[model samples]
Target: MTSPSTATLHPIGRSTPGTEWWRTAVIYQIYPRSFADSNGDGLGDLPGITAHLDDLAALGVDALWLSPFYPSPQKDAGYDVADYCDVDPLFGTLADFDVLQAEAHARGIRVIVDLVPNHSSDRHAWFQRALAAEPGSAERARYLFRDGKGDGGQLPPNNWESVFGGPAWTRTTNADGTLGQWYLHLFDTSQPDFDWANPEVQEEFRRILRFWLDRGVDGFRVDVAHGLVKTDGLPDHLPAVDGDSMGGDSDDVPYWGQDGVHEIYRDWNRVLAEYAGDRALCAEAWLPTVDRTALWVRPDEMHQAFNFPYLQTEWDAAHLREVISESLRAFPAVGAPATWVLSNHDVVRHTSRLALTAENPQGHGIGPDSPGQPIPEVGLARARAATAVMLSLPGSAYLFQGEELGLPEVIDLPGDARQDPTWFRTDGERYGRDGCRVPIPWQADAPAYGFSPSGATWLPQPAEWATLARDVQEADEDSTLWLYRTLLATRRAYALGSGDLEWLEGFGTDVLALRNGPVTVIANTGDAPVALPAALESATLLIASTPFAGTAVPADTTVWLLAG
Candidate 1:
């Protein structure tokens, strides 16, 4: 392994005329409330993000995808959107968002805003009006409001479980103080799911898309993309496994990946295609297979869907190779580029998750409070290696905020400090996602790690965060931040995005070697260093997760070589 060299960096990828920038673009995911707080109000806002645009541009990302900043009571953070068109006062005004977009675009970075079409906050005016209206009123028809199963409407409409926990249906009280209709909420009770069967619901989202597109957004990252349409009759479905788990393979999982959802995207796709600048839609759909996931990105559907299987695969060479091959083969059939991601606001940070035992691979809700979890140091090594491999692969890559600095899950937040509904809903059996949502550390010595001047953060930062602060990492060439910067820069230099991936042979089961364009990416997933195969031994090393001294690729490290 060798240290990254000081090479003048190029942009994420070179754009030719009529080329779709998103096919190989590197998009950074910004969880608004935790990214940067410019108002000193203890929350990250649009202006805060605007203040940091230069830093993001320097990071070499091609676009910025902001998680919802919409008006909300925040029962599920910003996912419970109260107003689709307005910004939450806590985050800033709509005017602030425009400035953020302008600033990001000015720096040659595109902006993709989150669109939560599957549901809306119970506090949304439409949902409120539904509560005031009669059971069959037009206002109540916008969402999934149904009669309960039992007499007197005491029981829930069905046995469907919420993704957060508990029953998916919640009984609402009418203005007269009597128990009213039960509405469906796949997530938190505050997030009422929409009835996609309604024409008004479908048209409302079209208007919303035009509203944001008219405002100059480059694209949208669709939340719960597969969940727009449900099975007819809202049938009762109880899987043999934990029904609440995401990305199930069973077709019996009633609410996910229904055939009708494709038609909705096809309609949405037409609206996006009407706009200039290739305004794309990236689906957050968690389907079962690479082939199935590719359907969301078919010719008339979304442009890209998040590759959760790649993100969820255990740290193994053969498993990774198979996923890469499948994803590459499947997406090209639809003429869409695959999207890669590691950490996100909803899951446990990869660095922390990879440190855990392989049997429980996903880091979704794990935190410091979880007993017997492995230390962060062990995971940081593999995380660095894994990121190098992911960035080198053919596709667009989504980077979670602070992942460049090797931030781990802040698992130690006090019980009362937690806000994720999963904790309360599951009766503390699950710790929830508050740990990974901790504000990113920027300045090592600054209060609240420089996330806000007021030193107020919605989630507490661990003391070890000071060592992993961006400022500290920026000054160190061997830092994880440097690795990411170098990797992105190198990936661009080689123009390896959306290319054929040919797997190289003669490597151990723990070693993965592949060629894309003129560059070869090799990874050592085992505990011991491995010698490079005959073809790569003489190749020039471009960048590596660790310092290279000889022909050996280090344990848990990935290296890129210039093809011979």
Candidate 2:
């Protein structure tokens, strides 16, 4: 139970020639708007990210995934992309992105850009031209423009609802100024879904992929990976997805996880194979189960898919054990490693989520203004324990930007300051993702936590973050930031990323004990302290989330032990 400030570090052989760097890599997700801001202008930009490359490189992650920085109207942040091949002026020019990519590569870190192919901004040239042409014209053929039902086409084509809220279809004006056709926008009105059945649409994305690949990007995180190809005939049905997803996990859903999406990835895989450096593609597919999700990451498809099931599991030992076991069993069957993630830009942060109570019904999203009481201190402990257990596993782990500093969801963001489409579309019924995406605290005393030089931020940060700033944690050995650095160093020392997981029985479901090579991770999620198994009483202690001096592990804590 003794916690150490640091672990013995070793040189990793991850960069050797002929090696697939992503197989066992640790990747960090950066929400571009929240990470940093170079200009005093209220938003973060690409130059801001380039200025912080040293910070990420020292964090020990093998790769960094940049959320959409493409040109857009910021309708749904940057997900509503207008141009796919170039960086948006709000972020930076193409030269800034190239400089960032080069800087990252120089530090032995790979870069993964977000690819939002499911839809494009309404301002996109294709979509604008579609509005200017007739319903059946070639200009309108690339998107999901369909004729409405009922007399005079008053009703929508189907009963499908937008994942944000309201109907998924929005009527477009024809050349004569009459409502001509209905176009589908699964997320937001500003984002119109594309007709994947069209060969022209598919070819355009292929060229876009090569465009970024030619610029030295290592891979892509395919946004809405399962929603590209809709069901034929635009069949009508309800969908069962979580608060943060448009891609439904159910098979009956018309616009998600369709079979035709495979052909797109198969073609993409071939295109990736054409490039050197083993360029990879990871999916953001939200399938029903990891077993079903495995279908999207077959050898000829994506290299990795986010384990959403594991992310949503309740903070119970048995539930976590079950989902982790499912993820472990499912991904390897396809020669792809299971990717573990706790939080992302689209969902509530794990630190706040793990503290959900019956009163705090924000297992998905949180709002401090709403009637609920969330325990922040208790949640931080569990989040740290979960990170320890996840990194100790035998697959890649993705870390959200500010989790290391134990940042909580900004549940009290004012209604007027919120910008997520879900918030506006739902009329504030759901708080949306503004809470988890506040600008990350960097300097303890600087204005706007040093996010922007002018003390201006797109989303306001909490005053309490002063204590959790990076500079504060950098000085304290017991801080979460130090724990992350040491754990990452330890993970590389053992090469635990690409290995097998063997569960240790006899401990029951209240405690999860698994052996990965020289490390044995034992996590106790119960209300009472638990003694380590008798055989491991003599095992060497590597590190722990909470500082303790006893052989029995504290409740809601995880310890990594080195096997003899």
Report the number of the highest-lDDT candidate: 1
Q: Could you tell me which 10 consecutive residues in candidate 2 have the lowest summed lDDT?
A: 1-10
Distance from true location, Cα of 231 in model 1, Å? 0.9
lDDT per model, in order?
0.86, 0.85
Runs of candidate 1 with Cα error greater than 4 angstroms are 1-18, 240-244, 358-364, 369-372
Those runs of model 2 whose alpha carbons end farther than 4 Å from true positions after fitting are: 1-19, 240-249, 358-364, 369-372
Give the Cα RMSD of candidate 2.
4.6
103-159 per-residue lDDT for model 1 (tens digits): 677678889999999999999999999988998999999999999987898998889
Task: Give lDDT: candidate 2, residue 151.
Answer: 92
Q: Any residue pairs clashing in model 1, and if so which?
A: 1-547, 1-548, 2-547, 2-548, 367-411, 368-411, 369-411
Shift in Å, residue 511, candidate 1: 0.3
Give the C-alpha miss distance for residue 273 in model 2, angstroms.
0.5
Measured by TM-score, how close is model 2 to the native structure?
0.95
